[model samples]
Target: MIFGSERQQHKILRKNHQMEEGSSHEITSPLLSNKEEELEDEKNEEDVVEIDENENSPIKQVALTVPTTDDPSLPVLTFRMWVLGTLSCVLLSFLNQFFWYRTEPLTITAISAQIAVVPLGQLMAAKITTRTFFRGTRWEFTLNPGPFNVKEHVLITIFANSGAGTVYAIHVVTAVKVFYQKHISFFVSLLVIFTTQVLGFGWAGIFRRYLVEPAAMWWPANLVQVSLFRALHEKEKRTKGSLTRSQFFVVAFLCSFAYYVFPGYLFQMLTSLSWICWIFPHNVLAQQLGSGLYGLGIGAVGLDWSAISSYLGSPLASPWFATANVAAGFVFVMYVLTPLCYWLNVYDAKTFPIFSDDLFKSNGQIYNITEIIDSNFHLDYAAYERQGKLHLSTFFAMTYGVGFAALTATIVHVGLFHGREIWEQSKSSFKEKTMDIHTKLMSRYKQVPEWWFVCILIATIAITIFTCEYYNDQLQLPWWGVLLACGIAIFFTLPIGIITAITNQTPGLNIITEYIIGYIYPGYPVANMCFKVYGYISMTQAITFLQDFKLGHYMKIPPRTMFMAQVVGTFIAGFVYLGTAWWLMETIPDICKDTSSVWTCPSDTVFYDASVIWGLIGPRRIFGDLGTYSKVNWFFLGGAIAPFLVYVAAKAFPQQEWIRLINMPVLIGATGMMPPATTVNYTSWIIAGFFSGFVVYRYRPEWWQRHNYVLSGALDAGLAFMGVLLYLCLGLEDVSINWWGNDLDGCPLAHCPTKKGFAVEGCPIFT
Candidate 1:
């Protein structure tokens, strides 16, 4: 052995002693403290290389993203395919729209069809044959051409997917009748809803080459479906002492199915348990800070996987790098900043509850929105001023501030990072310069040319114009505004579509459109919504369509077949949703009114409230330079600047690849998911994120890759199954189970924040 000199040996020993001391300190420190956790997180992050985007990362375990480029030979558009797909489409359409009017609307995923339709499809495939069932002079037809293959399954799923998204325009019509006490003829309502809901498809078809064909444009969310399909169809061979994919999937699905029961039902308290709230049960501050259901969950923990996975998506899906930035911002804003601002009475926040999305009066009562609006659906400024400005929770206000920031951040981040690539790709794709495996395979099939999309786009625009012309008094929209809305949607489609394709999120143009319409058509509430919906939802719908297009491309389904399924599915969805909306309105008395026995149309109420706030009252009265919350407007500029700062840092320290970890859009986008999620969701989301993306990926690499998405799918399926069962068997039947034991997850202390003796109505919550 080579021995160093005495001096060199002393230097080595000293270095060892210093490392031992640092290790001791880190291990000895309490992990429960927020400061300690923050430090630990920073250190842990420094050790990680790439997240889900890096294929080598254990977090992205699915080795096979897209299966081999074989011929997609099986039938894609058989007679049975349309029949089954349309039936499933109508069923989902009916159920989704049926639930949209509920206090807490239940949304079922298309995973139901993904799993359930396999057997029925196979059965039909086995029984039916290509032996001419129907014969015409020109053509002979069959119910089945071959076994129900992946193409058939994919097409069926596509049919069911059309009704997956909530029809936003129905809310507008429902709000007019149920909340605002105004009436629209059924024909006009159906036309408005149908046009707005499906108009984006035209734009989606137009941008397919730019957004759908590229290999790098991986929509991470879509991979779950791809994985599921591969598992069901692509047979896997296993060696001795190894678990086959099927065996692993079965075990995972069963485990998730069993575990979800506790958090999902029966002992619901397990869903959210704040030790702080338990320790200081009587302390209002603790409850305000810790409870999950009512307050911002500062020190709360939830056991429900579904609740944890809300809004942000499965922890298995988000990369740790993005997760870290979001958690950092979420904790800083929700836990630290919001509390300081509320305690110090920023924006007179101390006058209202510390946490709520609802608007409040000076006396801490719910704002009487009807009293402030005129018969024409525009704001009565004189009445509003007399009633005083509407107030929001400190957290809610911050969400808006962050929403504005996120909006601009999305724009700037994409432009800075992907703009050049997009430009280069644009030139190539248009000239037919680039082709990947999926695109090449797709080329063998006859393409749906650009003119098909153009014709549909022109026709829809014509219909929209005709509707506006005929219902000018009701719609309050000029022909120019209609054109302008579609133009804005078309202009932003390519950029947002590209972003969605890569990030699995579309940076919405909702705020931008609302701001534009508020300024341009300030007094016309209906026109403002029309403009906002056309500008925003159209783009969103376009993204959804393009996402499906890419999914079909990856699966090797024919473009023309996809075109048929989507068009037919969309029409069915529109009809079904319209019928459901009309049926519920007519059947239920005072349909949108708050009722303990039935759904009160919470989604519609929110839609109505937003319309009143943005369309009727306008942004100038809320977020302008002279508005009550004028300080928040600065976030717009701040949002734009944040990405530039990150860019500069990346440029300066180019070797510190970890510098890419600072994602402004992800951070800001996460903070703004207000309606569907609250503080509890984000806190639990971060906890799950670190576990899935860090600990499991690093230590349990095999399980991480094999069962992560499978487990997520199982959990989602289980929760959906349970939710529907409970709703049908208990909720609709009004099976009363009233007791302290049956109280909502959080009670008494939660939602009861003490601020100068709090009151929501005439009574003080503290008392």
Candidate 2:
């Protein structure tokens, strides 16, 4: 799936050796070359051969980007590193968790901190004293460890990466406290956050042989950071009439910072410019076709970078083939399948808005979720029966079905495509003779004992079982449920890790995990939420840890230092994430409930909706034979068959190279974030991806190779800085600028039901 046979590997090695002898700094693969005829072959060959002769990585990108040597003398765990790394981790954790509740929830990645920490690290190196605490003792340490080095920079970035995203277990805490209106102890919440975050360390340790040490399992996304690191650390020779990478990044960052004020606060309509809705403002059918936020956005586009990269992530970092696959899936689901189902009024679709994440009554009203819950936090079947069956918007329901398809498709797709390669890799992992340059170089350092991970795994599981069993009244999950969740996480980690390693796309287990526990142990929403986090997020955390390990491997940071950095960072991030969320929940009045303010909590809304659907109400009544939409279950079969067909087609048309690129899981799961991600997000993301990944990359490859990833990181940094500034300076004081330009969606009628006599307040009733 990733690399071919031993013969092919030898061939690639020979080709790479030839490439390493050239005179240029650019890296290109014949397999990935586009428009080769337009370029001079001599120049291209020279560019390809610029790799270091000592570099033994089989992946061309790694050979070109990562340095082949390491300086073991560089200090990584210095006092300066600890101070700066801890600050970066804690600050990002607070900022990200704080922003998670906003309407356009901006996730500022570790790239920002990676860039910001450079100057601070250097500043600390320059200013701090080099005085040792204990002159000749074993406990002696210096405050300044000479000049700040790249290894320290890598560790700091790793620390920031730990806190870049909000803790997943917080969703359960927020759902119970804010949405479900129940009390959960702070101590109990802390355990959930800490354990869920650290439980993956064990999985990462167990699988690092196959996932991290191998040269073939090259994680594509890490290349962006690798490129950024080189740009920041290595000296560059500037060409005449062209800016250096850092210069371009600075310019882009300033421009992005200045421009975001319009879309972020002053003129919010630029975030989603639905001009089609403007042309036919009063026509419901037209609005339904064109509304960027609430319907199938036909010609809508977002001018805001946040709107584009917020949900789907930066398109600039993703490969064109992967972007193409996602675009194909988005089009099929959003344009074709969704519209067809709605127009046909499948499952009373016309009674509700075509695109909404909110749970609803059958008659198109918001469901009274609180009414069905008893005082003890369990579902009251009598109250549920009296209130009638719960309903979901047609789009939301279909998205769940698609999620089901994605889970099965991922399993089938990986088995059909990557099974043999994975088996071979697994077998080879045990053979010390097969070690690559990176792994061999790493062997010089003291290896982290496997017992370290084992102890953490055992302690976390014990604490989890104790917490759930002891606090059974609040948590509702049994000790056995905790074990089951861990089993599911352990089972799926390797398969999902393989897909992520090669393709840069990870199929989530959120739906499958929830569905399982909901069927086996239904009614307690807390139990279901807890189960999903352990089963799903733990696997995700493992992949994240492994990804960091690969970055460390490429950067030549010692394995022991990486382990310490990640473990410490995870603990710090977990505490800060929970603390910030708890503070926000207590301080803000009607936080997620408010429709007028920016604190809408779009993601948490979806999380709460899921808790109600799969936990409070249970999946048996929603997706099983007892449900109104039982036929949607056919998607699981469809998902499994589609991948098999793709595999068969690839075998049949061996010469048709394009056939292999039709990734069924990516296509089917394209709109996985639909409830929180709207049409504008996908449309804007695709356009940006095409321009950068296709046009610039194909035509001006040298420029694309250097500036593309830097530009992505710069844009994210600029937008994040401006967004936080806007909120603090203006948003906090409730500053006013009420005008037509501030109307974000401009499609009030998009959410209105088209069915005659289906009355909804604030919408025109058609009789």
TM-score of each: 0.87, 0.92
In order, the Cα lDDT scores of the candidates are 0.71, 0.85
TM-score of 2: 0.92
What's the lDDT for candidate 1? 0.71
The window of 10 residues in a row where model 2 has the poorest summed lDDT is: 42-51
lDDT of 1 at 276: 69
Clashes of each: 0, 1
Colliding residue pairs in candidate 1? none
Return the top candidate by TM-score. 2
In model 1, which runs have C-alpha deviations exceeding 4 angstroms?
1-63, 133-138, 238-242, 257-264, 590-592, 595-600, 739-741, 757-767
Error of 2 at 108 (Å): 1.8
